[model samples]
Target chain A: MEYRRSLLEVRDLHVEVEGKEVIRGLDLVLHRGEKLALMGPNGSGKSSLSMALMGHPGYKIKRGAIVLDGNDITGLSPDRRAKVGLFLAMQNPVVVQGLSVTNFLRAILKAKRGEEVPIREFREMLVKAMGLLEMERSFAARYVNDGFSGGEKKKLELLQMTLLNPKVAVVDEIDSGLDVDALKIVAEGINRVASEESAFLLITHYRRILDYIRPDGVAVLMEGRIVASGGPELINQIDRQGYDWLAVKTA
Target chain B: MNVPTPPLELAQEPEELKNIRRKAWNVYTQAPFPDRASTLWRFSSPEAFWIIPENISSMLERGKITYKLEAPNGLLLSDLQQAVSDESVPVGALVGPEFGKFEALNLALWERGAYLRIPERAKIDQPVVLRKHVSGEGLVLDRSLIHVAREASLTIVEVLEGELTGNGNGYLNAVKEVLVEEGAALTLVEIDLTRGTTRAFVTARHSIGSNAELKWVLARFGEGVLKANLGACLSGQGAKSEISGAVFGFGQGKSDIHTFHDHVEKRTFSNIVLRVVLQDRARSAYTGLIRIGTNASYSEAFQENQNLLLSGDVRAESIPELEILTDEVQCKHGVTVGPVEEELLFYLMSRGVPREDAVRLLVAGFLEPVLGHIPGDFREPLDGRVAHSIKPATEVENVL
Candidate 1:
């Protein structure tokens, strides 16, 4: 028998934000084209784990090694890590005043593509992508998420995900504040970006999002560690028995 | 050109004009220069403008003025000497000596000026450009008098450039007075991109008539010290004014801007937005006031000043004040002075944008409220100047 190494491997992760430990000794493995649903009760450090993997400044890695595609990316800056193909769909998108959506998207695309796109082509691509998210054409003219509603913010993050086309994406609570229609649209958008060449880690607390986009694996994150991992049946069991069963089993 | 001495008297000038200049000079000489103790001059270095009357006169003489008219039909454009001599143009009614000390000095010794008069009910759709250049180390006093008659409309653009020779410094003091008659409209754009260690002082006073409208846009990207005093008086019913300005200060430059919106009549409206970006050791300060008089009922006034500091050593101060004596009027002022938020920076960085470029984007966005308000023709040039001003701070060879 032969074993295949995972595309992303988190080994003995211990993360802290502002000198307080949040994610303690967590380990997870994800393969290319795999959708891993990270589920847990509130305060289980699911978001912290995702942020730690992305090398957020506020989340200090006390002890961890995040290997991406056989390269150690634990010490890279957030921007460098992004250039290396890591993307995080933040739960609450930041409202950047004064920067238009078009300019911001063009800049990020330019930085990633390593060349400036012609104005006409850039505008065309932006309009097309905005259309996919059902956003108004005028949304590109407004400041970056300056006055967007909660669902609109989520759609914006998803819009960037499709445009940037990262190799590995960690979507943190992408469906938390979204309505049912927005949730389906966002899930469809996520599915549009997820291809055979990329991997996804969907960090969520609710089970509704899983209904739209089927997950290949389900992992229960309890007390800062992956206490259980299984097929889609695990989601049903957790839905029926709640996370208490997993907590008691871990204890 | 040799530096001229103070108390310059033109023998051929009219007695009334001569008497006005003499009175202005007397007032300018007797009034002491503004000191730091004065609340208005606290953020600026008062000694930066300390000079004798002869030096001020000399600086005013070195500035050259050119008047370019895109629509020469229904407008009268002339130099100060000719405009004052012509009986048809009422120069005295446009500018007066009671404005301030800077106005006094400028009105008394201005060597070069442009007077523009638009005929009643005529609309000059094209922009009238006024190019004023100061060469060598001297004083420059340039005056602009604009009169838009009843139901008329005009657009004016003023560009001030200074090129200092050798190691000498130049001082440019300018005054612009605009009168928008009943049902008239006026749009004025002022761009200051002077180089060297020259000092610039611009005082602009506008009077809006009944049912008239005024829009003023200012861009400041000079290297030295800049002091701008802009005021608008909504003296007639249904008058409206919108003033917007963007300033980018880099290196060791300092910029101080003061704006006032005086609503004196019923149903008047005014809005002011000013944006300032400071990098390196530069500093900028903005003081805005909105005054609603007793009879200015149903008036609406809004003032906003936002400042962005790119470096730790840079400083930005915003002060917004309001005095309302009338009821049923709406007036609000907002001031924000801070550096770029860490969350915004991190959000951009997370999307593969380098730190330096992220900062640049944030700074550019900080000025958009004012930059977007600029007329389309002037927006690109002003945007380019702002980008050039912050180039040094944003240049990065490599980011880890």
Candidate 2:
């Protein structure tokens, strides 16, 4: 595929973690302001693609190109990738103690942007984000996702995403552990972030989330490769027919 | 940070340390300094022998000691000296031929309070917490006293934290006494996390009144040779006591916890559980005794100790003893010592977690029975300290 002025472009990317290849020459492009949904079954390497792009330690780039904007980020560390406008909403975030959620977001924002926001501005941003996610104000004072329920943890990730606005966001399986009300609030939060200037690659196994947050494009990933790409209607087809449709079409 | 300290040279507490110093030295000299013939030093490393009382007062100059009160009532928080003056308290420092090692303590005991009196029908949910911190080096002598009124409930949490790392020798001699009035409930939780060439001596005793209750938890971690003794006396009818402890000893550290619970009252109850995890060349020992007197009829008492040995060289010994001078007491005792189950480690490794990661989590969760018992406020710091204290199963590369 020809690369346009896309925010993120993964071209023929093959990745391996600890000598085991998980992503084989996968190719996909997330344009600026576009919402691309990557749907795949378990072990289909949906998370690997995001982890590889975010530069997780275990994943090795066997062959391919991961060009963010115009700079190649194939060799960058996860933190560095994060600094350069790349964000990954982890499936299961690491629990860190002695660090409050508010503190973590501020540090992450400062590190990623290379500058710290004033206390008032930070608090204002926090107030707004909490309101948008319907989160209790007291939640900010607690440790980062420490002893949090499944719904609370998912909401926390969305809270981080809302505060630190990135050029490209790769949300991996955000819909897995959310309740109906929480899913709606999270979708509203994600929809507010999605615009013409910011690109989002939302990876989900279920299609129920597609109802709340409309996608500009949809892609099917099977056997570590994108098998199909089409307009918004593809989500409905998958929802009605399931992954079995993708299997038949791919075959 | 490197301000010059007054060359206080800890040499046996000096004359300024006064009476307590004189008695501790006398006991130190007669104790023979844990040598070859002694059973106490049989499993402990010999290098720990150099940790003498030589210059203990000097510790006041090198380390930082800051304390925070547990909460609203402020009660007795840190400053060990203030604890003695708050009430006329006894530190059990009597010079005697039978217990000659504590001769110095009698001289140092502050005679303000005789007992912790909990007024009858006083209901309390707030816990009394004390934090003791030390940095740099030297010798530290700490003490505290607690009294509960009748029907009053209280919890005491003591956290001893050490910061920075250097070559140094330090000794901590801390003693605490608790007096429970009739119809009172007293709970005590102690966390001792100190590393380096340090030696810690902790002595504590609890006295229970009629229909009063006592609960005590002692969790010891980090790298050091620690001698801990906490005991309780049920001196009145219908008094109750429950004791439990967990110790994680690794590297060249040594830990020995000896508890003596006396059931001297009628219809009293008692229970005890002690667990130890030994790694590297470290050594751990748990000795406990439950003595039921002749008049203590219709009473219940139990004691048990378990040990997990990570390596062959790391040895663990347990002795659970019972003295029943009465025929109408319900009592039992048991002891277990062994290595970590290979099947548990294999089960964890089968998942995505690496062997080191798996082992770390296993050891952590293995001790969770005790860790989980701790209240939430101090849980994180305690876990972090334990994670660091248990000899970090995984070594990090100094890439930075």
Cα lDDT, model 2, residue B53 = 37
**Model 1 interface DockQ:** 0.63
Clashing pairs in 1: B59-B138, B59-B139, B59-B140, B60-B139, B60-B140, B60-B141
Instruction: For candidate 1, please provide the TM-score of chain A on its own.
Output: 0.96
Find the candidate with the highest DockQ and give its number: 1
Please compute DockQ, using alpha carbons, for every candidate against the native two-chain complex: 0.63, 0.02
Leading candidate by TM-score: 1
Local accuracy of candidate 1 as per-residue lDDT tens digits, B1-400: 2334445467766778777787677657767677776546778775665556556644555555455545456455677677676655554454566556667877677656787877799877778776766666666677888888899987887776656543445666778888899999988888776776667777888999999999998888756778878899999999999998888888787898889899999999999988888877888988888999999999999998888777777788888889999899998888888777777887998999987778878877887877776567767766776656665444222233
TM-scores of chain A across candidates: 0.96, 0.94
RMSD of each: 3.2, 9.9
Cα-based lDDT for every prediction = 0.81, 0.69
lDDT of 2 by residue, B1-400 (tens): 2212122123333344444444454554445444545443444444443333333344434544455555545243433343343544344432222343432332242221222334456665776666777566654555555767778787777777774234545655566668788888878788876556567766777888899888887787766888766788898999999887878787787887778889998999988878787878888877787889988988999988878777777877877778888878899888878765543433222222234543555566556656666777866776675555544442322111
Tens digit per residue, CA lDDT, model 1, A1-251: 34555778999999988888998898899898889999999999998888788777788889979988888899988888888889999988799988988899999999898898889998888888888888988888888888898888998898888889988899999988789999988998999999888999999998999999899999989878899999988889988989998888888
State model 1's lDDT.
0.81
Off by over 4 Å in 1: A1-5, B1-6, B56-76, B88-95, B124-126, B165-168, B391-400
